[model samples]
Target: MDKLMPQIESHIDFFLREKLPKSMPMVAMLIGDKTIGQIKEVFVSEISVLFPQLIGQYADGLLEDDRLYPMLTEKLQSAAVYSYISGTQSKLKGLFSKVKWGALVFGLIYGLLIGLIAA
Candidate 1:
């Protein structure tokens, strides 16, 4: 267990630094796609009542996808998202360090208690 700490920290650091940044674009795209879909669904019914069926579908495709997808993707990939992720990663690192120390202390105390009980 003592020898495992460095390995665990290294892997977690790698993931937070490397994999997360690389995956952000895809995550943004997915979020944009989902948001646009939901928005289109919400408005499409009202639009259909106001227009022909074909026109309504065309409006749905054009209005939401063309505008909202890029907007959402941009928003998701903006500085705020990255900053939030950075903040969370730092917090997680701090929490992990605390947990590591806590576990060590708990293990020592547990062992000492067991030894004293046996004696």
Candidate 2:
């Protein structure tokens, strides 16, 4: 187990250097939570040669994928699942752009008035 650690690091380094064009961090950040979990599930198979020691960290990371996959699956009903997920931001951009500032202010004021009345 201990010996395989260096081998894993070397393999990852070689992949990052020779195969991946840019840093994985940038790519990973865009992949989202559920897809990341699927990646982990596939990569942790015995054929991948991942060490048992690093398994804890891998499992933890996979489990922490609580970002927004569940919400998107509600609409994905086609063959190009990966493409749909990869293009999530394109369709959902409107959701992030329209901020309910007035509603938020009104809600705050309403809450304050309610608190005052209760007091």
Candidate 3:
């Protein structure tokens, strides 16, 4: 098992870097719970399909090892939080653009009204 641990860690690193984003939407579904079982379930049910060989090889270590599970959950949660923040930032940008345009229009109208009154 010691010999396999490094290999398992390397594989997990690759999975997080390469496949996690692609599977993020599905992984996000399991974000509420931070347990090893939930993390394992998400990986097994969703992420495994994307990289069967990697999951198959390391699934046991990922689920059963105390050290590995926390690492995996931390990575998963960070990804989910990043995705949520990015989505919110995008929405806020859109809203800010609209508000900016509205303010410009309001200013133009107010200026025109003032000009008419002055005239």
What are the lDDT figures for the candidates, one per model? Answer: 0.69, 0.62, 0.70
> Against the true structure, what is every candidate's RMSD?
25.6, 22.1, 20.2
Q: How much is 106 displaced in model 1, in angstroms? A: 1.4
Candidates, ranked, lDDT: 3, 1, 2
- What is the C-alpha lDDT profile of model 1 across 65-93, one tens digit per residue? 76788887788888687889989999999
Tell me how far the alpha carbon of residue 69 in candidate 3 is from the true structure, in angstroms, after superposition: 17
Give the top-scoring candidate (lDDT): 3
1-119 per-residue lDDT for model 2 (tens digits): 65665575566545544445355666755665576456545544542554554687887886777854664565565448768776996766766555566578889999999999999
Candidate 3, residue 99: the lDDT equals 100
Off by over 4 Å in 2: 1-79, 96-103
How displaced is residue 30 in candidate 2, in Å?
66
Give the winner by TM-score: 1 or 2. 1
Q: Give the TM-score of candidate 2.
A: 0.22
Model 1 regions lying over 4 Å from their true place: 1-64, 79-82
